[model samples]
Target: MPTLAHQQIHPHPHNKSAFAKHVILLLSTMMAGVLQASSATDQHYPIDVQSCDRIVTFDHAPKATVSNDVNLTEMMLALKLQDSMVGFTGVSGWKTLDPTLRNGIGELPELSPKYPSKEVLLGADADFYFAGWNYGMRVGGGVTPDTLDPLGIKVYELTESCIHIMDKPKVSMNDLYNDLLNLGRIFNVESRANTLVTGYKKELADFQAHLTPLPSPTKVFVYDSGEEQPFTSGRYGMPTALIEAAGGKNITDDVKKSWTQIGWESVIDRAPDVIIIVNYGDVTAQQKINFLRSNPAFSDIPAVKNNQFTVLEYVEATPGPRNIEAIKHLAKAFRAAL
Candidate 1:
């Protein structure tokens, strides 16, 4: 015969197991709370947690003359420092900008081809090179930081478009804001930069607050960069954020890479409500429209059929302070099309 304690326990073994399970659940809940608090703390003190190597400090402002590029050109315009631009290349979209704003900036010189030739760039005698993209450094074609560094010019790549290995951290709104703030600091305009940052944050917050709830989120197709093998802004890219904020679905949201190419058939099957066509260099809105219309595969798309197309000028669409303008434009266009 078993003892009284054993007999009592054996009769209700299930109760003991149930109690053990409750204890485990309570412990897990406590752990989860701790983790949540830790995450919150990290968010609160992000700067302190960031790696030291990721931080780049500038002691004094650089007198930067931007090469012909999209984002940097727009940033200069937003800052009203157009006088500082001495030399540039790629002049196709000069006419597309608001005529009022572009009044005094007449007949821009094609200082260089797609990438400025070494002779043309050197002739400009710039203090610093501010390039929008990394392709400026092609061998034998244009001047690069490595090529210009010897000639007493420092280069600062727009951190937003810094995709190369040697470039800065991943692009974000914070990165763009910080770059502007840093530029302000360098140029002895810290106060003005802070003011700009304040305005930008407020505008973004306002947009976030007024976002309309969708009955069914409209599918959107973003045609970025290339046409031969379509490049799209995937999970981490700016296009993904742009689509999400405007209350439309990014067709390529499922793609895990920063940018990816997809099949034309896939896009046709999904039948996106709106189409975004980005133009850089010599590519014009009319050219993109013509291509879409001429192509047998894409002529039947709902966006094309309905004429629901929004075109973004190079500088406005690039990730920078001008991004707010792009987002607003997209929202307006999406609403109008719907």
Candidate 2:
């Protein structure tokens, strides 16, 4: 019941319906004794609960449009519910949206890039707010779910960003699938969700069958997110799968955890065949490449010598429905080098 905005504003959206329901039932049974001792009105607190108590629930799901980013919005479209959206932000130039959805996405006002003033966000009269994560809305900065809560607006965080309650124990293609399933249920589109999941699995299976086993997989390094210290994904993260699917060995596979600090000496010792840098909002791929080429330590590596460097959009690297496409693109890039 703590009202700290950031505690719930996790990087990923999470789903805790099953666990929450069980706990609620157990707690309500125990609290029955305490409630019986108090006034009858006190007993009503446990009876009127909605599944997710952190945010308020509406009597009817409202027309919503997501403003934070594309992955969540695209998944909704895949569910055939793009029409449910009324507005979005930071997507005027999006090329991947279906033509129909593009028009819809375009019509919606942009509330992001920078968080909209409290008045701007509320003025949309949105019933539900969908966000990729919480960074866009933090306390003492811009309006957050808490800001909208008092006004009776609801917010649903994308399940992929929910680090605490992800349906998959870890972030992976499996986690994205789980989120798609949950979104289908949320929007009453189970059959469509099932169809999309089936199609994606079949496509991936077919693609995997065609890949010849790696005869001599060379060590490859993914240098994502940082220039000075270098932030890279370790063995357990999405980058591991990306490296393997592309038929290359990940040099960072021995390290554990999602993101970690790595020393320049490790890169020198491993001597990766290829290096990939992820590009996002402010930094371009060219900037990362320029940084590495000028660095004293990496300039001598074989990867740098051969210019076996590549860059990918940050969204494609994230664990979501688009990951298979990312893997295929990486595989193509790696295979071309051979």
lDDT of each: 0.63, 0.64
Q: Lowest-scoring 10 consecutive residues by lDDT in candidate 1?
A: 45-54
lDDT of 2 at 256: 60
Which candidate number maximizes lDDT?
2
Q: What TM-score number comes out for model 2?
A: 0.68
Off by over 4 Å in 2: 1-59, 90-104, 115-120, 134-150, 164-168, 216-218, 234-237, 253-263
TM accuracy, model 1: 0.68
Clashes of 1: 1
lDDT of 2 by residue, 76-104 (tens): 66676667776665443432333544654
How close to the true structure is residue 38 of candidate 1, measured as C-alpha lDDT? Answer: 72
Alpha-carbon TM-score of each model against the true structure: 0.68, 0.68
lDDT of 2: 0.64
